[model samples]
Each structure stands twice: as C-alpha cells, then as structure tokens.
Target: MNRQAQAAVMFLLGAALLHAGATDLYLRYVKAGLQPLLLASGAVLIAAALATAWYERKRTRAAKAASASASASGTGAGHTHPEPRISWLLLLPLLSLILIAPPALGSYSALRAGTALQKPYALGTLPAGDPVPLSVVDYASRAAYGQGRSLHGRSVRVTGFLALDRTGTPYLVRMALNCCAADAQPVKIALAGKLPPVLQPDAWLEVTGTYSPKATHDPVNGGPIPYLSVTSAKPVPTPHDPYDETWNN
Candidate 1:
C-alpha cells in the first residue's frame, strides 16, 4: 500500500481499538484483563500512523524542492505505483469495530461447539451469600469431576445464554475464550427443574440452583454433561462481558 493508505489503515485500526476500549466493547471479544493493553496498543498504532504521515509529508516536500531545482523531467521524483484495491478490504473490520461492533458469542456458536471442559480442580468451599454467584466455568468444571462435592447443597447462582441441542434438552451455556473468539469454546450445564415455558435461545439467564449429582451425556461427544437442579430462573439482559473467563486460567 502507498504510505498515505498505510497511514490511513493504521489510523482506522487504532481508532477501532480505542472505540472498543472506550465503550467496554473489547470485553465481548477478549478477556477482561486485556482492556489496558487494548487501549495502549490503540494509542501506539495511532502514534505510528501520525509519525508515518509526518514523514511522508516531509519526504514529499523535499522531493518537490529537488524537482524544482532540476531543469530535466528525468530529475523529478519517480512515479509511485497505485496500491492494490484488495488492501482496502482491511478497513472493513476496523470500520465495523468502530461503527457496529460484533456482539459476543451467543447460543448459535455455543450450541454448535463441542464442550470445552478443563481439568477438575479443588474449589474448596462456597462463598458466603444467600444465592452465591458463581461462574459457569466453575460450576461446569466441578460437576465434571469428583462428583461436584463443593457445589452440593449450596444455593449457587450462575449466568449464561440459554441453548438447546437437537434433542431439545435445554442448557445454560457460556463461551470460554483462551484469548479471543477464534479459540472460544462452550461450557454447558444441563438445566433441570422449574424452567420457564418459553426458553429462547441466546437469551441471557441468571439461574439460582443446587448442583445435582446425576449428569447427562452430551449429544455430540457423549461425555458427561453437568446438571443444575434449578430453584429459580429469570431472563436478564446480556452482560458487557459474556465469556466465562475463569476456565482458561
């Protein structure tokens, strides 16, 4: 690409990153911890773009001065090749990010993806609360191994998008991202008891429930799917950050 186009692309990309950070939109694509990095990187890109523009201006002026001092056409600045049209397509994502950022991974991607279960860990004790809030990753992990002893009898609340497999079995699902959406995987919990009549896919839900010892098999993998014996379930607006960030760590 020409220097002008190169600088423009850099500026647009930087602006897009800044826009994501400024609006907390980065949470949709990456882990929460990357917020500062996103902001800083955006600033760096913009600075580089400005510097490139400045240098290009200076070079152009010097070339013009040299040409003015020359009497022959051969002494003038050489012609610059036009940048490839395909290169401009790079701005599509940047413009989308700045103008209409993508929504977080939802039921469509979650249900399509196979379960991503991390090795079980000792969660020890439940936190203090009437309905203790828990991440979907934690609940799913515990339920995956050691019979979920930590979650037994505890009134735990978890949030996730609602989804149903081909069998119409409802699950409370959340995507777990390693770094970004390209590596996103779904952590699903089979929800049981006291379900609403109308459970729409991609609808966000906060469910208060106790862990059930019995589990179901995944339709795709046939692996043990964790169960949550729910006490209450209510639709809630989607959160700023939708990925279950705890699992990757």
Candidate 2:
C-alpha cells in the first residue's frame, strides 16, 4: 500500500487506542500501566502519519514534474519510474514518543486505592446511618492516627475481596493487583458485628459501620495495628482489573 494510506490506518488505530485509554471503562477493565503506553504510542502513530503524508506528497509532486518534463522531451516514454522511499515515515511515531515522555503510574495510584484519607470512627456499636464506601487507603489512614480516638464516631462502608484466615472467617482482605500482586497489602478490618455466611476467597464485600479500633498485632510487619469493626457485611463481585482504584489519568 501507499505510504499515505498506511499512515492513515496507523493514525486511526492510534487514536482509537488513545481514546480507550482515556476512558474509565478501559481504566477499570484493562491493565493499569497500559494507558500511558497507549497514549505514547498513539502520539507516535499520529506523528508518523503526518510525516508520511508530507513526504509522500513531496515525492509525488517531484515524480510528476520529472515525468512531465521527460515526456515533453520524448526521452522518458519507455522508461519506468522508481518507487518512492517511504521507510522514513516509520520513524515518525517512534520519534514523537521519545521526544515527549508519558507519565508513569506512581504513589497517586496507591493513595487512590483509598488508604490515604482519614475518617472519623464511632465507639461501641455504630448508630444506624447512611452507608458510605471506604477504600483501603481511607481505613489505613484513619487507623494510622491511632483508630477511634481521633475519628469521633463516624460510620463508613468498606469493600474488597474476602481473604480468609485459618479460622475460616475473613479477618483480613487484600486488593488484587495485576502488576504488583505480591506487594498487595492486607486491608486490616475487624469483623465483630454481623459477618457474611460463606467466605469466598477473593470474594467482594461491602461492609458498613463506625470505625471501632481493635487491638491486633501485625503479623507481617510485626507491630500493633488498629482494625475496623464492621457493622454490616454483604457479598459483591470482584471488579475487573480491580487494582486501579483511581482514575486520575
């Protein structure tokens, strides 16, 4: 195919990938680190298309002029014209991406995982209130402040997969990661209230209650840590590519 046509196809594909990466559906369902790569690739494809188009146009113009002049001189009538060099267009996209580096996934993703924010917690049984979803970051941040002492008695809903302990009850849960599953930290929560009937590994759940601090020694980190006391619990489906909790990109 001609350089112009090839470039056009590449540009279209690049645009489509870029659009998908920018959307929430792709961010949620697709891999987390892929968005930036897509964006970078798209930019490169676009640049390549533009360069190819320009080069082809110039070559065509030059070829046409040469043909016209040769035909006028009656010396090019039996001569065959050589194909234009279009390979240089291939470097356009690559050069564009190299020039403008895309941003990499960073701590913002972890913070968005819901472990960074501080929330108020209630003492004893939590009073009936509206349900609010709390992320791991939120629970962790509040617990970091020494639990219920600082929360001032507020209820929150937490959701994640059920990570069962040896006792069959899900005492700890973790957010699955596609890129860094091993680094997944357990969202420490206390399930003292009504617990779910059947605990499924990696089963999603929505828990609502005031943050009542529980004295639990961290087994992994080897330290004393606070856990959220769940008031209500229900099963939920695990999200596709659940690792990317934040849609900052």
In TM-score terms, which candidate is top? 1
- Cα RMSD for candidate 1? 2.1
Q: Which segments of model 1 are wrong by more than 4 Å? A: 72-80
Q: For residues 99-167, write the lDDT of model 2, one tens digit per residue.
A: 443332332232224321223352233346656455654555556554454355677877755554455
For all predictions, the C-alpha RMSD in Å is: 2.1, 9.1
After TM-score superposition, the amount by which residue 40's alpha carbon in candidate 1 deviates from its true location, in angstroms, is: 2.0
For each candidate in turn, the TM-score is 0.91, 0.53
Instruction: Give lDDT per model, in order.
Output: 0.84, 0.56
lDDT of 1 by residue, 59-129 (tens): 98998788777746565555767878888788777777777867888888877777887775456577777
